[model samples]
Target: MSASDSSPELSSEIALLRQPGLIGCLAGRNLSAFSSQVQAVAVGWQIYALTHSAAALGFAGLAQFLPMLLLTLPAGHVADQFNRRRIVITCQVIEASAACLMAIASWQHWIGAWALYVLVALFGACRAFEMPAQQTFLPAIVPVSLFPRAAALSSSLFQVACIAGPSLGGVLYGFGADTCYALCAIGFAISALATSSIRLRFPARQRQPITLESVMGGIAFLRRQRPMFGAISLDLFAVLLGGATALLPLYAEDILHAGPVALGFLRAGPAMGAVLMAGIMTRWPIRHNAGRTMFFSVAVFGVATIVFGLSHSILVSILALMVLGAADVVSVMVRGALVQLGTPDEMRGRVSAVNMLFIGSSNQLGEFESGMMAAWMGAVPAVVIGGVGTLIVTVLWMRLFPGLRDLDRLDDIKPAD
Candidate 1:
C-alpha cells in the first residue's frame, strides 16, 4: 500500500521502513558502522598486544583524530557542493581499499603497530567526507514530519550493528587478525554498493565559492543557535570526560580476567543498551521537556561511568555500560533531532560537519585522554575521575545554556535564518 493510503493507525516507524531509499541508507550505514566496530576491536587488541602500552591506544586514537580534524571542514563543503551519495560511495570504496591493504599486511606477517595506525588514519580520512554527506540522507529521503522517528530508528539499527560487530570481530580475531580485516573489507564494499542504490529526493545543491567565511559558516551558524551549540558542546564535554570505552581492553583482561570473547561482550554492552533505548524512543519519543531530559540523561551517563569504573565483576561492568549507553542514546536522539530539524537543508552538511568534529573530538580525543590518564594513574582512577568531570560539566552546562535547558519539545525547534 502507498504511504498515504496506509491506515492512520500505522506506526510512523513502519511507514519510514517502507521507504526504499531509507532502507538502503540504513543497510549501508549499518554495514559501514559494523565494519568500523570490527576493525576497532581487532586494532585495539592487536596494537595493545604488540606494544602492551596504554599510551599506544591513545596514539591510535590520535592517529585517527588528526585526519578528521584536517579534512572534515573541506569535506563538509564538498558534501554541499557535490553529490552526497557519490561522496558516500567513494569514501566507502576508499575505506574498503584500506581494509584490504590491512588484511594483506596482516596475512603477509608484515603488519606492525605503525602500519595499523596508518591504515586507521586512512579510514579516518574517508569518514571525514562520508559522515556529513551521510547525515543529510535522512532529511532528503523522508519528510520533516517523520524525521524524529526516522532518526531514532536509524540510530537503533546502527547500535545493533555496533553490538554485533564487536562481538563478531572479537570471535573472528581469535581465528586471526587477517580474517577480521578481510570481513571488514567485504562489509565496506557492500556498504558502497548499498549506498549507490539510494534514490535521494533532494539531489540538487547550490555550489558556493570557496572562501574562509564559507568554510567557517557552520561554526558561525552554531554560534548563533544557542540551543544547538549548547546541546552539541554539552555532548562534547560529557563524552570527552565520561568515556571509558577505550579502557575496555584493560578492564576485560586485567580487571575482569576475561579473554577476547569477553572483551567483545564488554564492547557490545553499551550498544546493547543504546539499541534498547533507541527502540523505546522510537515507540514513545520524548514529547516534552526535551532539554531537561537531555541534561538528566547525561547526568545518568556520568553516574553509570562511575559505576562501571569501580566495578570488577563482568556482569556489573556490562550492566553499568548498558546504563551508560542507554543514557547516551537519549541525548543522541534529542540532539540529533534538534540539529537536523533546526538547520536549513543548504547548511546541513557544514553544520553536520561541525557536529561530526565535536563527536570525533569527544570520542578520539577522549580515548587519548583516557589512555594518558590511565598511564599516569591507574585505569580505575582515570575512569573515576573522568566520570566526576562529566558530572561537573553537566551541572555547569545546565546553568550556562539556559536556553537549551528550558527547551520544551523537539518540534519547537525551527530552522535557523
Candidate 2:
C-alpha cells in the first residue's frame, strides 16, 4: 500500500505484513533478538559456573558494553557510507561465527571465563554496526504513514523473542552449553539469511565525504531538532533512573522471599506487558496527542517503578512491572517514530547510533546505579529513590522541551533539510 492510501486496510496490521521486504526485515529482527537473548542466558550461566564469581559476570556485561560505547559512532559512519544491507549481513555472519566458536569451545570443555568475555565482546562489536543498519530498514522499506504500526509490530515480535529465548536457552543448557551455543549459531545464520532477502525501497544515499565533520553530523542534526533531542533524552534519563530490573534478583530472593521461579516470572513480566501494548498500538495506532502521550507514559513508568519498589508481594511487584513495561513501549514507539521520521535518510544511521548509545548507556549505568544504591542503603530504598528521580526528570523535561510536549501528530513530523 502507498503512504497516501487511506483505505481501511491501511490501518490494519496485515497491511504491513503484506508490504514488500517488510516480512524479511521482521524475520531478521526476530531471529537476531532471539539469538542474542539465548546467548545472554547461556553466557551468564556458563560464566558463573566457570568462575563462581559475581564480579566476573559483571565484567562480561562490561565487555559487551565497552565495544558498543567505543565503536558505535564509527560503525554509524560506516553504515551511512557503505551498503547498509551488506553491513547488516556481514555483522550477522560475524555473530554466527562467534557463536560457532563458542559452541566448539564449550564442546571441547576448553572455554574459560576470559574466552566467554572475548566472545561476548565480539558479539557486542558486531551489534554496534548491525543495529543502526537494521534500524534504518523499517523507514527505508515502509511508507511513512505506516511507520508507527511497523515499529509497534516490530517491538511486539522482539518482546516475544525476549520472553521466549531465555526459557528455551535454560532448557537447552540442561542438554549442554554447547547445545545452546549451537542453536544460537543457527539462529544467527538464519537471521543473516533473512536480512539478505530484503530489498530496500529507499536505499542509503552516500552523500557525505570522509571527514571528521561528516562522522559527527548526526549530533549536529539532533542539536537543531529540539523535539527529537527532548524525546530521546527523556527516555535516557527516565530509564536510567527508573530501571528496577537490575534489582529483580534481590527483590525475588530478599524482599519477596520468592524463589527462582518467581524470579523468572518477574523478568518475563515486563516483556509480556510490552508485547501486549505493542499489539494494541499496532491495531490502533496513536493518531493524536503523540507528545503528551509519550510524556504521560514516562510518568506512568515512574509510578509503576515506585509501586514495584514498595511492594512486598510478588504479585504486586509483577503487576507493577507489567505496567512499567506497557508504559515504556508507548514511549519507545513515539521516540522511535520521531527519530526515524524527523531525520533525513542519509543521517539516520548516525542519529540511530547516538540513540543506540543512549539506550546502551542507560541500561548499563542504570544497573550500576541500582547496585550501588542497593549496596549503600537497601534494595527497597534504592529502587524507591530511583523511581522518584524518574518522576523529577519527567517534570523537568516537560518544561525544558515544550515543543515535544505540545506536539500533536507523528505523521506531521517532516525530515529536516
Candidate 3:
C-alpha cells in the first residue's frame, strides 16, 4: 500500500518508531535480550559438556530461577521506589561482570560446574531486577500517545531476541566458549550505554510500604480477576509442563548428533516459527473467539512438542520445534492481552511483577523440571510425557476456568470490582 493510502494508526505507529528515544529503548531491549540468549546457550552447553548429566543441566536452571523466585516482589517494589534507569544500568553492569567471569573460567580451563552455576545465578539476580526496571522505563521514554505501540514493539523484540540469541550464541560457541562470553559481555555493555542515554519522562513512583499487605497486594488483586488469572495460569501450566528447551543440548550432542552448530539451528527453530506466526498474526489479527484460539494454540504446542521429542531426524525435530514456537506465541499474545487490558493502572506494577514471576518461573523452572525428568525417564520419554501432560492441563484448566475459555474478546472482560 502507498504511504498515503495507509491507515492513520499505521502512520502514527511508524512515526512513533522514528522517535530517537523510542528507537533507543527498543534497541537496548533487543541487545540485552540477544545477550541473555547467547549466555544461556553457551552456559547450558558448557555445563552439559563438563558434567554430562541431565540433572546438572537442571541445576543450572535452578540456580538462575531461584533468585527470580525469591526476589521478584522485592525487585518490583525497588523499581517503584528508585530511579529505573539507574536500576537498569546497575543490573546491566552485573550481567556484564558475570559474562566476564565465564570468559575467565573458560580461558583457564577451570570451568567447574559449581563456578558456572554461581555465575549464572548471579546473572539471574541481575535479571530479576532488570526485568521490572526495564518494563517500567519503557513508557517513560515515549509520548503517552505512542506508549501502546512501543509496548507492543518491546514485547515483539523480546521474542525476537529469544529466537536470535541462542542461534547466534550456538554459532559463536563453535569458535570458542570464550568468544561467546566476550561477545555477550560486549553486548551487555553496549545495551547499558544505550539505556543510559534515554530520558525518563516520569518521576519515581510513590513507594509502597514494606508491610505485609503491600507486598501481597498484587496476589490479592490477581485472585479476584478470575479470567485474567485463569489466562495467565493456563499459560503457566501449559508451557511449564510441555517445555523441551532444556533438552536441546541433549538432542544436539546425543540424539541428533548435530553438534553446537546444529544445536543453534534447533534452538532457533521455535523462534523462527514464532516469528513467522507473528508476521501473519500482525496482518490478520485475531478478531473473534480469541480465547478458543488460545486453547487451540496450546494444544498445537503440545502436539508439536511430542513430534519434536519423537523425531529421530534432525530436520523433523527442528520443524516440530518451529511449530511449537509458533503455537506458544499465539498463547502468549492472547494471555498478554488479557493481562494488559484487564489490569487497572493502580495495580499494574504489582500485578505485572506477579505476572513476570509466573512467566519466568514457568520457563526457568520448566527447564529444571525437564532436566530432572529427562534424567529419570530418558530425554525422549521425558519430552513426550511432558507434552501429554500439557494436553491434560489444557483440558483440566479449560474446565476449571470457564471465564477464560468462554471469554471471546479482549474488551469484553472488565477488571474486578
Candidate 4:
C-alpha cells in the first residue's frame, strides 16, 4: 500500500514534517513550554525563599489552576466559536505581558509571595484560553489524513520541551530570579509571534449561541461515558494523591541539601524518563491489554513516588522520580487516546475543555494538597502517605469500575452518544 493509504501505522512524523504551518505551530508550542518551565522553577524557588512556608507555595500552585476550573466551559466555547488563532495569540500576549510584569517585579525586588501568586494566577488564566484554542487550531490547518502524525509530532515536541525547559530554566535562574522571569517573557512573546505568522485557510468550527446549556454540553456528555469518567477520575485522584512535585522545594532545602541548579535537574527527571519511554512507545505502540497497561503504569508510579519520598541521595531521588514520570507518561498516552478518539469533531472543543479541566486541576490542586499534607505531616511522611494512597486508589478503582479495568483495546471503546 502507498504510504498515505497505510492504516494508523503510517509514519505520522513524516506526514506532519511535510506540512507547512505545522512546523510553525509546533515551534510556538515549544517556545511556550520552555518559558513555562523556566517560570515554574524560578517561582518555586523564590516562593520558598520568601515565605518559608509550604502552604504558601501550595497557594501559588492553586492560583495557577483555579482559572482552569472556573473558565473551562466558557474557554472551550470561545475556542470553538471564534477565530482560534486570534484567540490563542491574544492569550499568549496576555501571558507574555504577565511574565513581563513578573520580570519587572523581580528586577525591582517588589514581588513577594502574594505578588508572585497574583502574577502566576494571570499566567494560569492565559493557559486556560490558549490550550483549547491551540488544540483545536491544529486540525483546522493540517489535512485530516496527516492529523495522527500531527498529534505524534506535537506530543514529541512538547515532551522534548518538558525535558529541556527546566534544565535551561534552572541554569538561567542561576544568573538571577529576575533573569529567569525575563526569559519567560521573551519566550512567550516569541511564541506568540511565531504562531501569528502561520497563514492558513483554516476554518473555525460552527458556533452555538452562548447559553448555559451549550457551555455545559461537554460535561453532560462526559457524565454518561462510564469508561471515560472512570479513567479520568482515577487519574485525577491517583495524581492528586501521588504528587510530590510541590514538595520538591522542601526536599531540596531540608533533605537533599541541593541548590536551585540541582533543583532544575530534579525537576527535569520525570520528563527525561518520559521522553525515553515515549520514544520507544512511538516505535512500538501499545496494542495489548491497554486498560491493564494503564493500571500497571499507575501502580508503578505510586511505587516510584514512595521511593522518591524516602531517598536521601539526590541521584536516587532523581532516578525514582524518573521512573514515576515514565509510568505517568504511559497513563497519559492511554488516557489521551481514549478521550480524543472517542469524541466527535463538533464536540471536540468541549470534550477537550472538560479533559483539560480535570487534568490541569489535578496537577495544580495536587500541588496545593501536597503543600497542606507536608505542612501537617512533614514532607517525607506526607509524600510517603500520598504514594501509598495512590496505590490504594488504583486497587479500588480497578474493583469499582470493571469496565475501565477490562478495557483490552482502544478500538473497542466507542465515543459517547
What's the TM-score of every candidate structure?
Answer: 0.97, 0.90, 0.92, 0.92
Candidate 4: global Cα-lDDT? Answer: 0.82
Candidate 4, position 141, lDDT: 63
Q: Pick the candidate with the highest TM-score.
A: 1
lDDT tens digits by residue: candidate 3, 306-407:
999999999999999999988998887777666655665455556667888888888889999999999999999999999999999899988988888887
- Superposed on all Cα atoms, model 4 deviates from the true structure by an RMSD in Å of 2.8
lDDT of 1 by residue, 1-417 (tens): 887787653667677777769889999999999999999999999998899888898889889999999989888888888889999999999999889988899999999999988988998899999999999898778887787788889999999998999999999999989999999999999999999999875556567888888889899999999989999999999999999978888888899999888989999999999999999888777889999999999999999999999999999999999999999999998899888889998899999999999999999999999999999999999999999999999999999999999989786677889
Model 4 C-alpha lDDT per residue in residues 32-128, reported as the tens digit of each score: 9888988999999999998889998899889999978888878888766777788788988888888888888888988889888888888888888
Error of 1 at 315 (Å): 0.7
Overall local distance difference test of candidate 1: 0.91
Alpha-carbon lDDT, every model: 0.91, 0.84, 0.81, 0.82
Cα deviation of 40, candidate 4, in Å:
0.4
Candidate 1 runs further than 4 Å off? 1-9, 201-206
- Candidate 4 residue pairs in clash (backbone atoms < 3 Å): 12-149
Better of 2 and 3 by lDDT: 2
Error of 3 at 280 (Å): 2.4
Superposed model 2: Cα runs more than 4 Å off: 1-12, 45-58, 107-109, 201-209, 249-262
What is residue 311's positional error in candidate 1, in angstroms? 0.8
Ten consecutive residues with minimal summed lDDT in candidate 2? 52-61
